[model samples]
Target: MKNKILVLGSLTLLSASLLVMNSCNSLPKGLKTIQDFDKNKYLGSWYEIARLDFVFEKNLNNTTAEYSLNEDGSIKVVNRGYNFIKNKYVASTGKVKFAGDSNEGKLKVSFFGPFYSGYNIIALDSDYKYALVAGESLKYLWLLSREKTMPNNIKETYLKTAKDLGYNTSELIWVKHN
Candidate 1:
């Protein structure tokens, strides 16, 4: 009887996990991601151009994210920034993996163990020099570039896309680079 209960509980837990993970895939209609994303070409450093304020990144500047391939086939994520409030630099390391078997643009990133969040590359430049990323919702969005800054035209283009996707573009905090 005990063994039967244990197996049943295990199956319940697995079902719940799947439900929670699927919830993170809720995206607005007409919001499309880049196609044929090459993970290898995207492995590098990206400067944060703009983002919506979040606790982990609040009061930060000169923010950057670096991605590299791990031997285990996961992506190593390194996020760094200067904390003006703390008057120091802060960095966090994380891991990322594709959410689907063959979709390189949709990823799940985890900083705290076993707690994953969506990391979708909704828009990207052909040369992989610029990208617009979104989380599970419109509340989590970021604009990234290979350089410290991006051209006005590119910024406007991304902003328009975000606006079209029902995001509040005015709430984006433009990141400062030093």
Candidate 2:
């Protein structure tokens, strides 16, 4: 009967959904939020220590991001980098706005048209020496610094932190600078 066919179709769709989730293709495991992100001290230059090899900065060196508060209560985000392979300097400007009162550190940034994406300040050092950023998902984590280089111990600690948040540290692409 029609009811029997409908039931079988629903079961098949449910099994397919479970199969896709088990594959782990899109959504990833990652941290939820930063305990307390100091807005004042965190607004400054931050070098890209490790990234997910995103297209915006592929083969780029001396990658750095600068954040400043705008007059309109928005965060001015500027990402600059030198492309070693292309022998060029690239700069992309964007705007970041806070989510709401309940989501202080959670933010939305727009770089490619009207589509805004999550940019959360997951972890930060007391002195702002290092920071862990989550770009909406586990596959979009980044280790940043005020300087071009990070200490070995610091790198280890950061990797561990990222791992604890359900991220795979081995997938991180270490960005080398000139």
lDDT of 1: 0.89
lDDT per residue (tens digit) for residues 1-178 in model 1:
9999999999999999967864556555677677798899999999999999999999999999999999998999999999999999999999998876445588789888777888889899999999999888878999999999999999999999999998899999999998
- Tens digit per residue, CA lDDT, model 2, 63-129: 8999998998677889998888888999999987765443356767777555567777777778988
lDDT of 2 at 19: 60
**TM-scores of the models, in the order given:** 0.86, 0.77
Q: Model 1: runs farther than 4 Å from truth?
A: 1-23, 101-103
Clash counts for the predictions, in order: 0, 0
Kindly report which residue pairs in candidate 2 clash with one another.
none
lDDT of each: 0.89, 0.77
| Number of the top TM-score candidate | 1
